[model samples]
Structures are given as structure tokens and as C-alpha cells.
Target: MNLAGLIFVLVTHFLAGRGVMAMFGIKENKRKTLALSMIIGVVLFHFLPVVLEVCHIAITATSISIAIGILTLALFLPVSYKLDYSVLKITRPSFTLYEALFATLLILMVIPSVWLCYYFPVFARDVLSGPEPLAEYAVREHTLINSALSVDLTSTNNHLKPPFILGLQVIYKLLVHPFGELWLSIMVCSFLLMFYTLIRERVHALIVLFIMMLFIMMPEIYGYMYIVLSDYPNMVLFFLAFYYLGKYLETKQANTFYFATFLFCLASSIRSETVVLIGLIVPLLLFSFIKDRIKPGVIALRLGILLVIPYLLYYVWMNVFVANYMHIQFNTGEQLSVTSDSVNIFFDRIGIILGPMLFSEHARELFGYIFNIFLFTLALDLVLWRKKIGLQARVMLYGIVVVLVGLPLLGAIIPWFDINNTTKRGVFKLFPLAAFYMANSPTLLQLSQAIKRFEFPELTAQKNAAPVMAQQQKIKKKK
Candidate 1:
């Protein structure tokens, strides 16, 4: 690889890995976000290598390495103050169906977008095809595919397999190796499974499910559905981890906690940055466990077990084994510029990513149509949930999860850049989780309730009402 090519590849991985590390500090599970971030870094670095030639700037090995280092540092600065495990204290747990519906619908909406983006070849077609043999692309991954499967994983990659990408490969192999038409089928199932779990009530299931199936309303999901990328599955992992965690929070049962923890661990392995999601969740969990000002010693012990232990293992394995022994660089000089607008570059691409009829330009029109059909049905869901769930609706719980998870995700996506990096990577993986949350949005309730007034059956009030005690007492006195 030439100097420019090397620079791009290295910096990309570095940026992505570091980004995941930081995200882990918050969510404790952002491996996919981390892996995809590196991809973004490489894409941005290699975009215009010749632009350097025209500028008379010579790319050097020293500059490339330093750039990666600085960018990594930049990613961690946000967490510098909040690095302590104290934040792991758990908090009050609640539920609301709206949140679940929101996340489910958002996932359905965005995966289709990601697929269209790839299949149509708008963003980066050279993806698996490998870049036109360049010299200075940064980082060096994709070596595993060459070594293990003996397939050219470097076609879309210059060197290494970012964890998210690796997880995608693993998931694909487990489900169906040599991906074909069935790719989308698997994608649909993974997403559907997580959302379906949120449907505890049969009354709202069909209504929420139908809204989620409206994939065309959201552009990002439409683009993701058909591609052989990590975004779809990564989002699936995110939702599953959180949904299970929400269950654990509500019940605090050992089985629920164990399953939730396992899913979170699995998610971290799937995408490094997902570690952030897991980490952030632990502290939020701690908030719940720490109330009543539990004995300091006890709190510390719980915090250690709940938040610190698993993460330390993940960190040690990733740095000591993956990045070091793997001998792969994921960043470069241009890609690293700390003072530059990496986040901006990420958001700028959103338009192209989402703007394509039943696509981006007419999102307003598409949304109006979708809401109209589902309006009454959604209303029925809320009424049913009120009767069934009473004060403990999963929707309220979902809103809390969104608030915790969506902030950083929001920070990552608001800015745009053409540079391939973490912000966009996280953005891409975020949509499915968002859809899953939306599946339980109040919008679903409104529609479902209306349906009850029309097609669905409604229970009648008791005809033989009992007299109030006060009224009975007055009648006896008169007699």
C-alpha cells in the first residue's frame, strides 16, 4: 500500500476503536458502533489521496501514526471526567409500551434504507470489491478472512475485520454462509424477534407489528435491509440487549438479569463500542441498586461486580490481543485531525443516506399515509395497555431507555462528515434500535384505540351495578 492508503486504513481503525472505547464508558456495549466507526475513518482517509499530491504535502509514516493516536485520545476526552465506576448506581425501573413500539418501528424503517444505499451503490460500492490497490491506506485488517475463510474479505476492506464486520460475518455463517437472497430474510428475523418480545399484550400486537412493517417511511432502514454490512445486526443486538435489560430492571430476577447481562456481553463482543452501551447501562442499573444510600462497602462491591469486572476483561482482550497482536492500524494523519469536524462530516452524509421516494424527499408524504391507516389501531393498543398493564406500561420504561441511550447517539449523528468515522457508523447502527423504541410510541396507541371503536371488540360495562354503601345506609335509615 502507498503512504496515503496506509494513512487512511490505520487512522480509520484507530478512530473507530477509540470511539467504541469511549462509548463503552457510557453504554458499556457499543462494539458495533466502534467497529463501524473505523470503517468510516478509512473511507474518509482514502476518499481523495491525489488531493495531497496537488497540495504538495508528503504523507509520512510518523504523521500517520501520530494522527491515529491523537484521534483516539480525542474520542476519550468526553469521558475523562466521568470515568469512575460510581456512575453505575442503578435507578427506578418502569415500563411503557410506547417505548418498545418506537424502537421496533424505527428499526423496520431504517434497515431498508441501509440496504438501498448499498445495493444502489450510492455511498461506497468498492466496499467488498477492495479499493483500487492503493499505497497509503491507513490500518491493516481483513487479514483474518484471508487467513481463515480463504475468501477475499479485503474487497470492501483494505486490511482488517472491524469487530462489527466480524460479528456480521459470524452471524451470516451461523445463519447462512455465502450470503444470498436470504440475507434480507435473516435481517428481517433478527429485527422482528427483538420487537416481538416487547409485545406482551395480544391486543396491541397486530397494531404495533403493522406499524413496524412500514419500512418505507424511514429512509435509513430502507437502505440497510439488503446489504452484507454490520449495521442491521448490530442494531438488532442493541435492541435485544436493552429490551432484556429493561426486563431485568423491572423484575430484578436472577434469570432476567443473567439473560440481559449475557446479551449485553454478546453485544460488546459483536461491536466494541457497544461496550459503552453496556457500561452506561450498568451505572444506570447501579442508580437503582444504590438508593437508600446502601452501605458504602456494599455499594462498592455491587458496582465492581456489575460494572467493572466484565468490562476490564473485554478491555484487556481487545487491546492486548485484538489490536496489538492483530497488528492492524485503524487511523491516519488526515483522518485523525482532532481539531477537524469529524462529526460534521458524519452528519453531512445523512441527506444522501436518507433522501432517496417512498424514500427521503417525500418522507412527510409517506409518514402521513402510514399514520392514517394505523391511527385508530394504535389508540386501541394504549387503552388495552391501560387496562392490562395499569400503571406499569412498558412504554414509559422505553422512554427512559431512549433518553439514556439516545443522547450520545444524538451527539454522534447531529454533525455530518464525508469522512468515514464513528459518528456515522453509530448513526447507521442506531436506526434499528430507534425503530424498536418507536413501535411502542403513543402514536401506535392512538391508532389502535381508534380501531377498537371500529373493527375490534370492546368489553361492556357491568349491567348489574352494586349500590354504593352510602346509598344503602341512607335507604335503611328512611325505612
Candidate 2:
């Protein structure tokens, strides 16, 4: 392992990401800021490899270092004029007993995954056919358009996909490990931290712990943490886009909204189909604008940013980048269907998903009661104990519908989006949305408040007394 190079990547990525946050004037609490900085840094660095390829620069260590130096300087130098030197100090926050236990458990769970990821060889067939080999030869040949493109492997069309995974792989293989998958670990850890920050403020620590455990234990989703696939990272970016968008609605922070749209663009670049998903979100965005009394021109411009950026990114990859590199012709139009049979196919796939895939024993093994729990809680909310669902929860529910319906809709339109393969992996996107809903559920919130009261009786008493005390003050004034 290239220890020095690995450290270089980690340090520079964090600083660069911090620089980005500062430049945009987007500040969160320190913990969240750190986590977001790391994620943003890693993703921004991945683009460096792609830029090198586009410029026909050699993908060597020297070239990578130079590009990174430039990028880091570009992002960091402007912000250097007013550096918060406090960022250098690492003060430890006091964790409650519940928080400590959960943090330790999460770390233990993640340690092995990281070790296994680094120790094992790349074995996923889809990866081998596309990103892995493409990355491997890119490292060996010092170019993205390498000898691998000359070979004919008719079994997979992954080669025709975007360079999101392949670019990161090339950078990691050049700078970190020969396997080039440690980048995924960084993404996973950073995302877990960001995810923790998301609901921690809304619920008690115990409830936060429970939700985090539930998310991490989803067998299929957990496996993707170590496995190098675009789906997992795609899921992270997609969820965060909506997450930050929700925050923007609540806070009306313009910078936060811009960041959310930027994340949506990044998600689309990871998977072209994500563009369709972003389009599905437009109605919700329009509803939000109309409700907010936003002007027609502002709504149109914001909508344009949401729709146009992702589409341009998709177009660039499929038309400009791939066309420039490969001779293969792609007929995406042929992939679409608009017949009665298409509607029938969509319903049939939905049935299979709702039936055998969701309720079967094998489904239990893959998802492990997570979805069942979500459905039960949602049913309770709808029927027996409906609490007023908040806007955040409603947005999450919308996201769940988008993924569940969107995947089959894609399958119906494109025959190759099979249930057993493409759609199955795509379901990974639903886990985060479901978990978010569970976090915001009235039952869970009530339980969380109970836990808080139990854990801090004095604090609860003070909270209870505050209203009565205010009432007493008003009575005295009237008398």
C-alpha cells in the first residue's frame, strides 16, 4: 500500500472540501461540516481524473499530484484569506451513554467491512467487466482511453456507462491501493456520519442509535458499503440531495438549495437513469415554490437548474465523452417502449416486487425486517395512530414513491431494466428514504420523547414547568 499517497489523498480531500463549504458560505455545526467537507472533497477529487482524461494528460502519479495541487489551491487559496484556525484544534464532544454505545457499535461494525474491503480482491462481475478492468488498464497504460477499449466483451454494456466509478478507481489505484476501492470506504464512512447528523437533531440519542443500526444492518445495503459499485454512492448523493432540499425549505438558505441541486447533478452523472428520477421530483419542487409564493421567474430558473444540469451532464457523458472514446453506437431510443404490453409489464414487475421479493424468506435474508417495520409503522400512522406528518416526512414518502414506482417505470420503458438485476440493485435507493420516514414517524417521535424524559427527568420537569411559570407571570401582572 502507498501509505504516504493514501494520507495525501485523505488530507487534501478534507481540506479542499472544507474550502468549498467556506467559499459557498454554507456552515453547519462542526461535526456535520467536517463530514460534509470530506464527502464533497472526495467527489470533487474524482473529477480530477476525468478532467485529465479529457485533456489527454497521462494518468500518472505526477500528473495526478499536479492536478490535485491545482484543485486544492483553487478551492483553498481564496478562502485562505480568512481561515478559521479553530479548525486545527480537535476538541472532543462529550457523548451521552447511549451515544457512546451506538458510536462504538457502529465503529465495530464498520471496521471489519473496511478491512475486508482492503484485504479482498475485486470479484463483482459487473465491476470486473467495466470499471475495474478499465481502471486497471488506465493505471497500467497511463490513459483513460486505453487498450481495454480495443477488446470485445459482448456480455456486458457497463463499458458504455458513465465514468463516475472508473474515474475514482483510477485515482485510487494510482495514489492509494492497487485494488483502488478504498475511495468507497471514505464515501461510506463520510455518508454514515452525515446520515447520523441528519436525524440526530430531531430525535433522542437512543432513537438515533436504533435508526442508524437499522440502516446499517440491511444486509444488501450493508454489503454495498465495501463493494465498489455506483449504486451505493449514487444512493448517497441522491438521498442527500433531497435531504438538503428539505433543509432549504425549512431554513430557506439559498446556499443550501444550491448545494442540493449540485448534489442532484452529481447523482445524475453517476447513473444516467438518475436524470429521470430528478425529473420526477420537479412536481414536488413546483408545489413547494407555489406554496412559498415564489415568483414565476424564480421558480422557472430554479426548475431550469434542477432539470437542465443533470440532462447536460447525461448528454455530455453519453454523447461527448463516450463517443469521443469508443466506436460503439448506442440506440437508447430502441430501449424505450410505449405499448399496452409495457403497462402490463410494469404491473407484473410491481407484483413480483410486492409479492415474492418483499414477503419471501429470501427477502427477509436480504432486507431483514427493515421494510416490514417501515410498512407496519406507516400503517399505524395511516390508520390507528396518525400523527400529523411533517413536511420532511412527507418529502421522504414522496422519495420512496419515486424510487419504487420509478424503477418499474424504467423497466417498463426499457426491457433490460429487469427485476432480478437492474431493478434489484436500484431498490437500494429506497432504504434511506424508508429509514428517514421511520425517524420522522409519530410513534418513533413519541417514543423518543419518552426516552428523553426517562433519561433526563429534571430537564423534562423544567420543560413542563416553563409553560405554567409563564401562565403564573401573566396572572400576577393582571392582578
Best by lDDT: 2
In the range 343-377, model 1's lDDT, one tens digit per residue, is 56444444433443213335444232342333343
lDDT of 2 at 448: 86
| Distance from true location, Cα of 41 in model 1, Å | 30
Ten-residue stretch with the least lDDT total in model 2: 322-331
TM-score of each: 0.49, 0.95
* lDDT scores of the candidates, listed in order: 0.44, 0.85
Error of 2 at 213 (Å): 1.5
Candidate 1 C-alpha RMSD relative to the actual structure: 15.7
Q: Tens digit of lDDT per residue, candidate 2, span 208-268?
A: 8888888899898889888878889899888988888877888887788888998888888
